[model samples]
Target: METIVPDSEGRGLLARLPGRVRDLVQLARLDRPIGAWLLFWPGAWAIALAGRAIARWDLILWFGLGAVAMRGAGCVYNDIVDRDLDRRVARTAARPLASGRLSLKMAWGWLLTLSLVGLIVLLQLERTAQIMALASIAPVAAYPFMKRITWWPQAWLGIVFSWAALVGWPAVTGTVSAPALWLYAGSILWVIGYDTIYALQDIEDDALAGVKSSARALGDHARGGVAGFYLGATLLWGIALWQVRPEPLALAGLLPMAAHLLWQVAGLRREDPADALARFRSNRFAGLLMFLACFVVGTAT
Candidate 1:
């Protein structure tokens, strides 16, 4: 059996789970926690930057749970919608839905289960935040179709992924502020850059399947495209911080994250799938850098 995905996964504790449980885990992507971390960080940043993060540590924990549940739900829904496309994509061909290891009904069931968990997390927030969170359903449902109709589905993904900032701000302050808006926009640009790196792994297969992405849209210049997006992200994040504190320190707080983005762009290897996946996964740390910056600025007197 030729492995479409690199057998690079060590399986660790997932290897200890029963066969069916492991399949379900794979279906929800619990085996790969990067997506959940990517999803969690924007909301965490928003909480931290809202100036009450230390006092509102509960928001971070609740949002973290929501990120995991909702990220899993989104992946399941995407797999369900893209099962045919998945079958043609090398990396996704072995996916439970694509391989028929999981029935469509089962996949839908899992999606609903995960969604319910997300809802519980949502209800923990203020009414304003709850409404803001619910508003995201339309975009999330529309996401699976974007790759088919648009070359820049990552942009749509950016909108959906960065929405946590919107929800988080209202959860903390009961309304959106300029800083939160800027942060959300910056995070959107960040997603486009990182997910574009992720799209690199599927560029060849996506081309064969008629799936369009920023990776293919930029062609050989995909590396430069990612660099541009990361630069835009850093600039917008600076603006976000500056709005909170018109100080050199707030902008300087962004230097570490900016340098990390530079590293990703400088090291990008478009032709190497393993290298692309590594760069893509490294955003998990990129996220940490941004969160620490947010915390510093948010808590600074």
Candidate 2:
């Protein structure tokens, strides 16, 4: 049997579990919660922006659970689809599917299990929210193939990952509105920016594997591209706040998030993979800052 190394991000936690159990946990990325955090924030932001953060705390809980489960399922599906490509990338070569620590059958079974958890959380949603959430299925299913056909696969990820904003706004307001649209739009750009940073880790291996990414496409201009994307996101989020409260102070809600994004861009070392991963992980805090802004602005009298 080949020795399997755990993903660096998850190694600490994974080291404490039994062999097979550890592999399963790693497969679901339970050991690394950053992806789930990113997936949950848009929904939380929408709920807060809909002025229901306190009234609909249950929805926040459900969305949080759903984010973890659904994100896990997405990772498993992506790993299964990109197993071959993963083997070609140094950063991803140790993933369960690519490393042969887990079989396709096991991966499929795990995906189904995680998806069932998502389904349970989906049942907690309103009919409109449920339908809106369901609508994301097609995009999510197609995401794994985007890198094969386009250099902007991150855009597709943005669409899929930011989908909770659509479901969340409807869940609270019972209808999708301009504010929700703006939040969703802004979130898409945010994802594109951060995922672009993430792709920096794989640029060389991706080139060798012929996998296209925004990071590779931007090349020497990646920092500028990230700056542009973050700027667009901040602007759209500002619009969302304005649409909701229409107060000058409402726009100030975005200042913290905007400043944080600026910090990420200003300090980003594009040539360093470790720096890229740290920057990518830092979006978890960025998400929290945005959520706090939404909560404060949405609840103001």
Candidate 3:
């Protein structure tokens, strides 16, 4: 019987499940929902920014569901691909596949099951949105190998995770526009910033395993690197807001989120794994702040 891993977020609930079920749940990362929330926000921002959120509320629901399923599938695939490397990282070593609690066949079955749920969500979108969503497959397939090839794998993750903005805009408006593009671009920066913080938790292990990440690349300058990425995200999001509503007050929508990102960067304890994990998790709230900004600017008269 496999016990809960150290990084699991829902240990109480996970503990009640049968051993195999618990392993599957952990394999899909269902125990930790921060990733799903992070994955969902870009699409939510896009829908709200497109000014059709209230009317197209269904898209939000669908995207939210899709985020959970697809993020899970992505995690399963990443685990399958990195199972060897995962064993080399203490934080990741106990993951189902890496720890030998789950077999490759079981992991593949879970991946397909999660992907089936994703397919259901994808079928709910309009043609344009569906096409846009399908286009993400190549990037998604390429992401697990990124750390092996580049220090900027977080950038590839940014690309993969921020793809919902492309689909959401088209889902709402039946066409992609400048606002969506800017939102996607800004979201990529945001992902890189937060994910760098996430990578801080595994810096030493990643180095020992020969894995590269922005956190390792930044070294002592990681805080500044995160600050730079956050700053760029804010500027791009401001530009996106301006594109939607050119009035001065429109840019004010970003103030709260900007302040939040600043707080994260200003107080970040780069060397503490706990602080790094806390800062990374706080992006869930940061994401909501940006969504509110997008909502206000997008829905304003």
Candidate 4:
């Protein structure tokens, strides 16, 4: 059987670009911008929710740069750690590190360069947001090892990816509150749900390589399990909103996001890898929809 290349992700441009440029693109995940957007949206939502209009644009811009830099750093770090495992996985086997397109030392150098860019972005934030951003370092450093120890690594990833909520609130309000905390919690559950769907794409490869993930843990019941996670995420987000504002209208904003989650879950197909990836990528839309809802709820008079 022939493998099909995704339209958005093929070896076309990378094959044409010079070595250094292509390597950098692979390290930065330029071919895959969804990860950066997923990391950025929650921070944007938190800023909008705070109604700090004066600095909102600045915060969003910095967080956007930070997301791209940090997400690149993460991919580099993951590639370094998973070099061996990645070689065994079909989809990831062609990754720069796994395919021998880039060496380990060069990858580390690239990682440091991206981290420096991330540091520059961090310096642009307020003292509190800077500190909040710094606090994520330990979690980010520790994430590559989570899969080796737990099937619920997706849970830990949620906690790490959603740290932007922590950063954004402090950047905007200069302090943490119950509302911001609830938003952070809700975002974690949302990450876990969506990332679990992503893991479904690699269940077979993961199992063969002795890897642990939510999809493999759930096995034949993966679709139903993902649905349950998405349902719980919606409920958690609703709880977060109620805690933050306690207004009936505030809860109404959650309805669309909840409905979207339901749609993703209902349409999920555990047996089809392509379908799983499509569903996973579609969460970018889910993130956007939720951010808009948060913005409306937070900024509305």
Candidate 5:
């Protein structure tokens, strides 16, 4: 019984599209918009917390578009590089490239097409933002191979995924500030937490394949690992908030988002892949909650 479609990442009508179209959609993980949201929010938060988000709505929108395009490009690039490894991982075995539905040549072509979309978004930003965006390339390119060598590949992912914060701040402020740096650091921990949860889905497969991940590193304490990461994130976020407003009360802004992260830790079930994914996807809302907190604090009198 040969599986023809990538069931792990694609679903609903998107999964039912014509074979060619569906393959393209799933290749970019368009069916899972949570990745886009997760990528977009850190930039959005940086903008909102920089105090001109309402006025600079256009930058926010451009960053959102950039997230979509770049994330797609990243997925395509990763798939092309990891096609062989992917075939051995159950959840990724049916990816278009791994399943033989799409050739590596076509995958590279798709990656360039998506990168063009990202380039268009880059042109909308100032030189500083453009440079910041370009700087992310090396880390992004290295990410697919991190698992082959490191127990903390998620840490590398943290650096790659949280990069939008660097771009977002300079796009508006015209310079990277302390608050933005703190926010990016916090986002790194946040990414580590959620992505570790995501990696739980492939623990056995990753083990069989001899790949490494934070989830495997944490072992029986995976839940506690996530909790520790989330706690570090909260502390960094709180520090970022305080740097912006310098008011002790501004720290309270993190309460809702912090509580949400805590709830994720409390509800974690390492044995259940569905539960792990649910926890991972829940970061979309966690991102929103943090954005609101930043907006409220950043806009305060």
Candidate 6:
């Protein structure tokens, strides 16, 4: 069941740009920008949700920088860890590490550079937010190995990816509340649902590699599991809103987002990897819709 992703000749032609341009693309994962948005949106949403005034573009700008840098660092680390397995997988086999375009030393150097940029962004955050950001390092470091040892690396990914919620609340209000915790919980479930879809693209390769994932664990029922997770996410989000404003109307804003999740579940085609990737990337829109719901709920009520 080795899935061979045919090379997009168009992409290969585009890669023929100057070598420097190619290296930069590989370094920043420009070829895969979804990770950056996935990382940034929760933090941005949390900031908007906690704001006493309209969400400021300046805060979004800073979080954008942090997201790009941190996501680059995370990708570099993942490549380092998965280099061997990556070489065995068709979709990842042409990556910098797997293709031998980048040595370990060069990869480490790239990782450090990205991390320094992320550090600079961290310095701009409030003290509480800065500390919260620092607390994520260990979990981030450990995430690359979780798939080897557990059947639920998607859950670990949830924790790692949703950390911006913790930092965002502290950035806006200097401390987290019960409502904020609920938001964070909902964010984690949302990550799990989407990342599990993502993991499905690699399930056969992962199973052969002796790696475990929710996709492989859930097998043919993955759609049901994903739906359940999305439903739980919507429920937690509604509960968080209720905790903040305790009004039915306060939760109404989330219904559209809930419907969107339902659409994702109903539209998903489990056996199609391309369909899975599309559904997974579509979560960016889901994140935006939820962010708007939170912003309206927090700002108006």
What lDDT tens digits, residue by residue, belong to model 1 across residues 55-131? 99988999999999999999999999999999898888888888888899988899999999998998899999999
lDDT of candidate 4 over 163-245, digit per residue (tens): 99899988888987777787888888788888888888788789999889988888888778877777776766676667656
Per-model TM values vs. the true structure: 0.97, 0.97, 0.97, 0.94, 0.96, 0.94
Task: Compose the digit string of candidate 3's lDDT tens values, residues 1-301.
Answer: 2222256434697889999999989988888999999999999999998888899898899999999999999999999999999999888888899989899998999999999999999999989999999999999999999999999999999999999999999988899989999999999999999999999888888999999999999999999999999999999998999999999899988999999999999999877888888889999999999999889988995
lDDT of 5 at 10: 52
lDDT of 1: 0.90
Candidates 5 and 6: which is better by lDDT?
A: 5
**Reference-based lDDT, each prediction:** 0.90, 0.92, 0.92, 0.83, 0.89, 0.83
lDDT of candidate 2 at residue 136, scale 0 to 100: 96
Instruction: Write candidate 5's Cα lDDT for 1-301 as tens digits.
Output: 3222233455678757898888888788877778989999999999999987899999888988989988888888888888899999888998898899987787888889999999999999878988998999999989999999899999999999999999999998899999999999999999999999998888888999999999999999999999999999999999899998988889988999999999999989888887888899999999999999989988894
Give per-residue CA lDDT, model 2, range 1-301, as digits (tens): 2222224344565687887788788788888889999999999999999999999999999999999999999999999999999888877788888889888999999999999999999999999999999999999999999999999999999999999999999998889999999999999999999999999888888899999999999999999999999999999999999998999999988889999999999989877887888899999999999999999999994
> Residue 19 in model 6: shift from native, Å?
2.5
Deviating ranges (above 4 Å) for candidate 1: 1-10
Model 3 gets an lDDT of 0.92
Ranking by lDDT: 3, 2, 1, 5, 6, 4
> Which pairs clash inside model 3?
none
What TM-score does prediction 1 earn?
A: 0.97
Our tally of clashes for model 5 stands at 0
